[model samples]
Target: MDVTIQELKQREAEGKNDYVLLDVREDYERAEFNVGGIHIPLGVLTASFDKLANHKDDEIIVYCRSGKRSGMAQHLLQQSGFTNVRNLEGGMLAYQG
Candidate 1:
C-alpha cells in the first residue's frame, strides 16, 4: 500500500506518531534533504534487513527520490514477511511539492 504526503503531514500536524519512516535514498541524497527516520539506503537493504526484524509487524513507511524505488522496497519488505510496509506515493517529489 502507499501513503500520500498529505496524509503524512496531517499525521505530523496532529502529533499522531504511529509509524516508522524508512528513508531508502543514498547518503548524499539524504544529506541534501530528509524528513528524518531510520536511515537505511535501499542499495544495502538486502544485507541490512535483519536490522528491521523487530519491526516486522510495525508500520514502516519507505521513501526515495521517486516512488519507484520505494515501491520496490515495499514489495521486498512484504515478501520478507513485514506485515505493514507502505511506500510513500510520489516519494519526496510530492512531499516537497
Candidate 2:
C-alpha cells in the first residue's frame, strides 16, 4: 500500500518505531537527503536481507526517489516473508510535495 508523507509524519509523531523505514535508494542519493530511513540500496536488498531479519514481520515502510525502486523492494520483501510492508506513495518527491 502507498502511504503519503503526511501519514508517515503522523506515524513518526506517534513514536511508531516498531516499523522499519527502508530507504532503497543509492548511497549518493541518500547523502543528498532522506526521511531518516535505513539505507539499503535496491541493488543490494537481497544480499542485505540479514540487515532486516529483525523486521521480517514488523511493519516496513520502503521508499526511493520516485517510488520505483522502493515499490520493487516492497514486493521482494513480501516474497521473502515480510508480512507488513508499505511503499511510500510517491517516494521522496511525493514527500517533498
Candidate 3:
C-alpha cells in the first residue's frame, strides 16, 4: 500500500504516532530534507532488521528521495514478517511537490 503526502500530513496533524515512519534514503539526502523518520539507509536495512523486530506487526510507512528505495525497503520488511507496511507514494519528492 502507498500513501500520499497529504495523507501522511493529516496523520501527523492528528498526532498519530501509532505507525513507524521509516526513511530509507541516504544520510545526505535526509540531511537536506526529511519528515522526521527513523534514519536507516537502504543499504543497511537488512543488517538493521533487529531494530525493527518489535514493530513487525505495526504499520510502517517507508519513504526515500523518490520512493524507489523505500519501495524496496517495504518489500524487504514484508518478507521479513512485517505485517502492515506501506510505501510513501512518491517519497520526499512528492512530499515537497
Q: Give the lowest summed-lDDT range of ten residues in model 3.
A: 30-39
lDDT of 1 by residue, 1-97 (tens): 7899999999999998899999999999999989999988888897899889889999999999998999988998898999999999999988999
The list of candidate 3 runs beyond 4 A from truth reads none
lDDT of each: 0.91, 0.90, 0.92
| TM-scores, each model vs. reference | 0.96, 0.93, 0.96
Model 2 TM-score is: 0.93
lDDT over C-alpha atoms for residue 88 of model 3 = 95
TM-score-wise, the better of 1 and 2 is 1
**Model 2: ten consecutive residues of lowest lDDT:** 11-20
Please state the error at residue 24 of candidate 2 in Å: 0.4
Cα lDDT tens digits, model 2, 1-97, are 7778888989889987777899999989998889886899999999999999988888899999998899999999999999999999888888877
* Winning model by lDDT: 3
| Candidate structures ordered by TM-score, highest first | 1, 3, 2
- Residue 67, model 2: Cα distance from true site in angstroms: 0.7
Q: Answer with 2 or 3, whichever has the higher TM-score.
A: 3
